[model samples]
Target: MPVTHATGIGPVPTAAPKLAPNVLDLFSLKGKVASVTGASSGIGKEVAIAYAQAGADVALWYNGNPKAVETAAMLEKEYGVRAKAYKCPITDSAAVEATTAQIVKDFGRLDVQVVNAGVAWEAGPMIDVEGHDEWKKVIDIDLNGAYYAAKAAGRVFKSQGTGSLIFTASMSGHIVNIPQMQACYNAAKAGLLHLSRSLAVEWAGFARSNTVSPGYMITEISNFAPKDTKQKWQQLIPLGREGNPRELVGAYLYFASDASTYTTGADLIVDGGYCAP
Candidate 1:
């Protein structure tokens, strides 16, 4: 494939590599093994589905939602791939490492890892965002969780020499919002974007790493917000509506597929123009 190509387009192939593998094959995850954190709900669940649709065996990690067990079954049935679910606490580094080890051991190989599990503490300003009791918790899960996942996934990627790592960031990482305050959320997400980019550069020549920053999506997570609050969010999005969790499937697919073989250290914003303005 040509080393350089058009935007959002896969690399152009002039002739097949002499001894190197077909880089186009990099886009196909068939026979690959994938692990996704926060696969129990919202964007996480859809990400797992997209990977499965790409033809990879999957290990889903969830902190809550007994439905994760069902999600696993459904994935296996629908995608014809082996699927397993584990309840994991990404906030704990050791636990994350151990669980990731178990997944690789069980699956025989771990090719893709998606750090999608995160929490947002809601309130007024940063001070009110999270009290002493909750402040640390929010930072721990949102920011620290990404670190743990990256460390755990990077280990396997480094060893294998070819893997994909995906981080779920937010449009909030780029722009601040009004009406409802979530300063802590914004800070954590912003950190995650850079973290993914740093890892991408560090892991270059061995593995691929990228971040997907999504805007306000309509999911069970936001279903708890008041109607007027959600409506206000719609007004903020240039699409004149909140995004659906499923809308992010295509972006996730591109990052996880060979379509982005030559791409790394980049931010794929599937924010429906929320960050465009």
Candidate 2:
């Protein structure tokens, strides 16, 4: 007899579910409800648009920029999908929980959640930094915020018996970046990688957890860096250039769709092969 566990825990599956014979169909997000944090612009905005284009109703979460509202409207008009912008401060655990719950309430069900909200550590080396405030802020948003999202979303996934959780980690998590001093950012992202993996095992019976680590993407987050700094980044990247935000969406799409059903506890790095060398 098969051993039994809690509702959202195992009895691990013994067989794979039959998939659509058409490979493309597996990539479709029709009728699915997805949510992306940090969706005001850059990588988050691009992912939100891509999800809408693929037929998922999306909730775009933003903290400060109101551009997300306009983006949502554009998605509705252009993609003909239900899309809405929400103001959510990821640093606040209560806000994160409430916002996530609100998305499920509005969308009826949430199939995918991408916790991509984060801040870059512009403050140079940790030791020379003025205060602990900067370090705490980075940890609060990048690491703690992600954990809050997983807890809130994990509950819904457990109840619904299915969901996908994706984190926007950084290549810095895998390797120490040169020409830049961001110990806090690196630590937070490294924590994210392990957090996702741990959640994958914990939520395996009902949901999947994964991460996408992008390297030197041309996003607003990097605007603080000088051109020469970026030039240094380009030299380290095997592709010899910074990646466009749009270029990283394919990995996000794969993790959000049925195409990655069997892929959990994984980190898909779209870093222009920077980590290769």
Candidate 3:
């Protein structure tokens, strides 16, 4: 028998070595379910898709988007996941409670709840802000709506023993913007962040909670800014551009899934270094 030093090892097995448990796998959301408020369009729509792609069944609620049915269909078809759309307005506590019940009935369970439905006023100073009715409308829709959604989700999560509550806050919560003013919107988002952190602490034992503070993300809402204004904003950011709404997916995913098992009460900022300086 000629033994060659270059001969392959004799102990080769028929199978590949098992991979070490991945944090990524731990982060997976397969078989879990999520409910996304304001999912008719914008970031909410994108988050719904992202959740589906992550192996979750999704329930999307919209206040007024007739197209939401199509969005629901798309999620189901694309991700091979169960998807549904509801017409729920977050400003109505009773409505939220009812809608949440419907979601649970349809989805079988809710593991993640994202409170992303919010409204903003046209950019301008406070005094020049159209009229009293407008100011109240913005606050009611933005601030109070978040409270209702969080409360409704909190109730279900408490009953279930484990869940994640996420809020869609903004960088405006930390720093006020220029050229255009959104005082009411700023205040509302600031309230949302604090509320999330407080809830995280209060719900520490059974559920996890967090918020995503996106900075100048490019979206239909951002189109209100003029070309020059947007250009100026880019210069302010160290990364030289505004973040896209899709960029917000990772933060929410971490909070909504098992990946952030040890994380809570955290504000994951996706501001493209705009707040760095």
Candidate 4:
């Protein structure tokens, strides 16, 4: 029988260098089109701005958040990149698909999709929280919505043979938060981490998939937590401070640009050393 070269049974072909000659060139997203969900405020808003600043036209998606329209305008005016806002109900798979298709239609191509729309558990303990409905709300937006977005973006990526998919997971996904019972939220994020890893392998040939699991950040979402609770977090965090939303932009940017072409299924945690211990 002839020797098989596919499994290292014979001479192996050397891989060609794929990175740009200049290091900065690898990070440029010029001419690319990026769509980010939950872009009205917080980390999502910052991420959209960063993508535009990196030279990519941006599409902002929000669920009933009209401020995203203004944010879109600001991005275009500030970065000189074409930007628009879409009211997308990410919880609905069909709505996500339609919105993604519309973005591609308006932009003429798709390059990056950031699934950052998520909600925190507000009902306190899981035992006291209203059953089914409350849990459903978090799971739908946090986990299922991410799945929907990936499905829509994966289609475009497959066709183009290139794309970037970034999910805004959380440090809670890696370790349970203290003094707060957010079982549903934690589970959803943990699931997202695994989902991204699975999709990374599945879409290896066409695109790259990764996650940015931020720790407690100074965002509107944190406002829901009691002041005392936040202080507790600061003490637990090794860095002794919460992160800023703008601080997360660099992680997402790296994943969205050519700089991370060889990186996939990676979970970059930016939680002010919360998980370091």
lDDT (CA) per prediction: 0.82, 0.92, 0.84, 0.91
Candidate 4 local lDDT, 57-119, one digit each (tens): 999999877999999999888889999999989998999999999999999999999999999
Which candidate comes out best when scored by lDDT?
2
Name the TM-score of candidate 4: 0.94
* Candidate with more favorable, higher TM-score: 3 or 4: 4
Error of 2 at 89 (Å): 0.7
**Model 1 bad stretches (over 4 Å):** 1-27
Residue 153's lDDT in candidate 4 = 97
User: Who is ahead in TM-score, 1 or 4?
Assistant: 4
Q: Write the per-residue lDDT of candidate 2 for residues 1-277, one digit (tens) a residue.
A: 1234667565657357577889899999999999999999999999999999899999999988999999999999999999999998898889989998899889899999999999999999899988799999989989998888889999999899889999999999999998999999999999999999988888888889999999999999999899999999999999999999999999999999989989999999999999997
Q: Write down the worst ten-residue block by lDDT for model 1.
A: 11-20
Best by TM-score: 2
Backbone clashes, candidate 2 = 0
Which prediction has more favorable lDDT, 1 or 4? 4
List of clashing residue pairs for candidate 1: 2-12, 27-258
Error of 1 at 167 (Å): 0.4
Lowest lDDT block of 10, candidate 3: 11-20
Clashes found in each candidate (C-alpha, N, C closer than 3 A): 2, 0, 0, 0
Report the lDDT of model 4 for residue 34: 96
**Tens digit of per-residue lDDT, candidate 1, span 1-277:** 1244667475444332233266656556788898999999899898888888889888999986767789899999998999999888999899999999999999998888888898765655766443475677778998998899889888898888678898998888899876778787888999998988888767775788899998888777665578898888888888898888889987887787777767788888887788787
Q: Put the candidates in lDDT order, highest first.
A: 2, 4, 3, 1
Candidates 3 and 4 compared: the better one by lDDT is: 4
